[model samples]
Target: MLPVFTTPPPLGSGDEIAVVAPSRPIEESKLQRACDRLRETFSLDPVIFETATKDWEWLRDNPEARAEDIMRAFEDPAVRGVVAVTGGDDQLRVLKHLDPDRLTSSPTRFYGFSDNDNLRLFLWKHGIVSYGAVLHPTVTVDPELHPYTERYLRRAFFEESLGVVEPSPEWADEWFDFETGDPREWRENDGRTWRGEETVTGRVWGGCFSIVKWHLQTERYLPDPGDLDGAVLALETSEDVPLPREVRYTLRAMGERGLLGRFSGVVVGRPQTHSPGLEWNPGDDYREQLRDEICAALDEYNPDATAVFDVEFGHCSPIAPLPLGAKVTLDPTVRRIRFQ
Candidate 1:
């Protein structure tokens, strides 16, 4: 049976949103722009936590400090929501310091992705609904927030529920150094593809593929397989750009854990085939090849599950934040997805 989660309160015009950094160090200038937009455009107040603007070394060495910021955010009734400044690789270290009861007591909407997925999942384990990372970064985009992003951000923040899940008109996979002031390029979105005939309705779970896999590996803060029954499993790769086979290995591990077979459907985001430092090239049909591997693993562990690929969500420009722990319907017959 799917677990029922307590939905956090919606944001009001003057509501306060806590800006925190649980993992990576951040640039104050970029963060200020995001905070400004939250105040001016979203009509919300943004309060930056002490840990958010700390230098890289300080953030790296101070897990307890990062955890303190998180505790303060949730404990403050004035702050209606909590969002990460950005994601990093070391958030696993910070999780140990969080007190589940104290965090869950307020049940404020928490948002993040990549490493921040760590906190989202932790909140999920306590039966509290939180959002995938989309709000903060979208506010800081160079030219402006894409309408697709704006539409979803509005729904996720102030509205009762994120309505329909749709593809962006255009998407970008590369990142530019914020100091350079160059805009990230956008290309026509190919949209999502369906691979099953059946329609399924289920609450959403899963986030960055690596974060989910790490939880399974460490058996840390993971929900019971029984709790995930009838869930729409949402998974995506980050800029780390794991090879196609590595994705399969993680999927296989989930299958072995008796976890993969419980989902009613799976949604995969577009994989970042190339990054600045990565050696991968797009000519190798990396996307298609990765699709095949995912299909193969699903066939082995979850043959009955519906699978959809290339639905933008994580590590991509113009993302639609998944309202984790909320119900969504995926109809492959017409190739449509709607969040309820």
Candidate 2:
């Protein structure tokens, strides 16, 4: 049997949440603005950890300190939850220094994604459920938080269950330079569509696809393949915006390792097609190509598993918070997902 991870308690008004830099160092100005927003909007106190605003050189050199900040936040009695300043490229370096026992013993609510997926999966390996969406520098720093993002964030933090998952009426693929004061932008969302079997339910697993690939390379952090049996694999590409062929190659690698066939279902987040170097916006056709490529890979590896596409998570704006290690019901017939 897979070990049952304990769900951390929900947050409430007046609670203190620690802000830590488990990946890249945070900008002092951005951190202050986010902290102020947290205080004003949620009536909660934001306690910034020392490492959150440390110099990039110090942060890069001291992976142990980053690991320690996470440990201390979980161990701290005053902290009700923990949130990351932002996600970065090298969080895997911090994993070797973390104590699994300490994390399991305290199991505090953690919110982050992208590179922080390392910590999310680490918490999962230790039987602790953690939230996987939104970060201080990204979603929280917005002049006005998207209503869809705010709604799900509230449910993930304050409520016992996220009753239903739905796509936002609109979404944003373009990232702004918050440091340089670029204005936020959004485009109309047509809606989400699914493929594969009509319905399937299982415990959730997965994070940023690139990070998961990194975990496989290290041969650490991931749970045994047996532990993931019958899981609903949730995957999303990052800002790097890997090509369709690259995505297929990565999934094919997982299939070769006997990982793909173990899951009963798959939920892939909407692909971020456009980035700084990419000339064209990733419009409908590009998304369709991504879906086809992913489905083709899944067909070759895990034909029996159901799959859903364009989920409102990962590198997209107004993403939903998925609790790692929790059960979720995916119904393609009705095009609905409900978190238990």
Candidate 3:
């Protein structure tokens, strides 16, 4: 039997949350703003670790320091949780230096997505449940936190068990310039759609599809393929917004590795179809095409597996957190998801 992961105790108001950079250093202004939000909005004390504001050159050269900061934050009893400043491309380099013992020993809530997928997988391997959600920088600089984002954040941090996963009333397709500190904008969400039948209950696994490809290539920090049997796969694209063909090929690669068929179900986050320089607006039609492609890939490899599309966790705004390595029930018949 697979070992059961211990859920970290939830944080309350006034607790100190450590802010660290396991990826690239965040801009100083954005870092400070995030710290302010943690203090003023959440009523949590934010402890900024040194690596969060280091120069890009130093961050690139000091993977060990980045890993050490993570370990130190976990080892420190005073810190109730750890939050990543932002996701970056180089976090995979830091994984080699992290000690799994330090992570399992304390077992506190750790939150971040995209590049932090590396750390999430590391923690998952050690039987610790980490969160896939928005980073500190994005939350801090927003003029007002999206109610959807705040609601889920509160549930993740304060509740022992999540009730139901609901679609956000609205979602943002456009990217925000955090350096400019502008308020975010959003469009209406039609709601979630399912591609398979029946209910599937399993522990959640996987994150940014591109990051999963990186881990697959490196053969580093990934759970044993057998270990993921009966797990639910959660996947999303990043801001770079990989094309439908790229998405298909990545899932194909997983299928080729004998990895795709092990899952009982799959939950795909809303794709960020828009990028800075992309000309055409990829509206509902394009999203449906991407979903069809993903469904096709699943059909090719794991025809029996159930899949849900456009769930609210990913590069999009007003995101919710999904607990890595935690039990979740996906009922496609009712189009409902519940985190246990």
User: Would you list the C-alpha lDDT of every candidate in the order shown?
Assistant: 0.83, 0.83, 0.84
Stretches of candidate 2 exceeding 4 Å from the true structure = 177-183, 278-284
Give the range of the ten consecutive residues with the poorest summed lDDT in model 2. Answer: 133-142
Candidate 3 error regions (>4 Å) = 177-184, 278-284
lDDT of 2 by residue, 1-340 (tens): 5787688999999899998999886667777777887787677788888788788789999999999999999999999899998889999999999998888888799988999999998888888888876455445545677788888888877887776988788877777567666656778888876777658888888889888889888877779889988899988988787777788888899999999889999998987766887654565587788888889888999898888888888787778887888889888788889988
- TM-score for each prediction? 0.95, 0.95, 0.95
The root-mean-square deviation over C-alpha atoms between each candidate and the true structure, in angstroms, is 1.7, 1.8, 1.8
Candidate 3: worst 10 consecutive residues by lDDT?
133-142
User: Model 1's lDDT to the true fold?
Assistant: 0.83
Ranked by lDDT, the better of candidates 2 and 3 is 3
List ranges where model 1 is wrong by over 4 Å.
Answer: 1-3, 134-136, 177-180, 282-284
lDDT of 3 by residue, 86-129 (tens): 88898989988988888888889998999998889878888888
Per-residue error for 153 in candidate 1, Å, reads 0.7
Please give the distance, in angstroms, between residue 63's alpha carbon in candidate 2 and its true position after superposition: 0.5
